[model samples]
Target: MKNYLFPHIFQPIGWIMFVLSLITGIAIYSSIPVFGAGIAETLAIDSAIIGIALGALFIVCSKERVEDEMTKSIRLASLLNSIYAYVALLVGCTILINGVKFLVFAVFNLVLFPIIFVCNFRLEMHRYNKMCEDEEQD
Candidate 1:
């Protein structure tokens, strides 16, 4: 099947967006004084969330520099792994958290899978690339 991934160029943009959004969200959540005068907290938080989601989407859906069969397989495996992780997290939250904290987690849960997938995918790719380099050096 054809993979309609974004160009690899988007990965860096995604990283930038993700980092900026995370910083902004954390600052807002922590009630940083710098953000006090300009924007509504709820609006800022929501925008941060949307930024994070878009960033993750761009990161996960972008094409690798070398899009081969192995990369495709790794992508599939990462996706499956992310789903498993997501379920485990959900179960853990359901069991261990309650009240407002649980609600907070529930809101963040929307972006969790994509973030997990990106981490898993990048780790796997790093490992595979290292193995290839080792083999080449042999």
Candidate 2:
């Protein structure tokens, strides 16, 4: 089978980057003093956003330990689910929010799909692993 994903080593790196950047982004957004120290201006926010998106991309695109058709299907389904969830969010927000808050959400929207996809994919993968373990134990 042909492989297009990143090496498995990148998965851990991506997780690290995703977590650190998410923390940094949260701190900056929440007005945390020490965490936001040094990182200033809109540029800082932009950098964090870019870091988050790249980290999520690496995570979702990285190869699983056992890359098989099942994993591929899981990835595809997770992606589709993410898209549906993202669109629902957008529509709901459009109906319920406006003005500057909406603009902020729009900016953050850039990374939401990948983040959602990663979460869904991880959850499904965990379920699959647990099922496999159960089968092995029986």
Name the top lDDT candidate. Answer: 1
TM of each candidate vs. truth = 0.91, 0.91
Q: Model 1, stretches more than 4 Å misplaced?
A: 37-39
lDDT of 1 by residue, 1-138 (tens): 777999999999999998899788788767786555555766778778888888988887899889899998999999999899999999998999999999888878877777788899989999999999999999
**Residue 104 displacement in candidate 1 (angstroms):** 1.7
Off by over 4 Å in 2: 34-39
On a 0 to 1 TM-score scale, where does candidate 1 land against the true structure? 0.91
Best by TM-score: 1
For candidate 1, give the lDDT of residue 59.
86
lDDT of 2 by residue, 16-111 (tens): 888888887887778776544444556667777888988998898999989999999999999999999999998999899989999988877877
lDDT of 1 at 114: 72
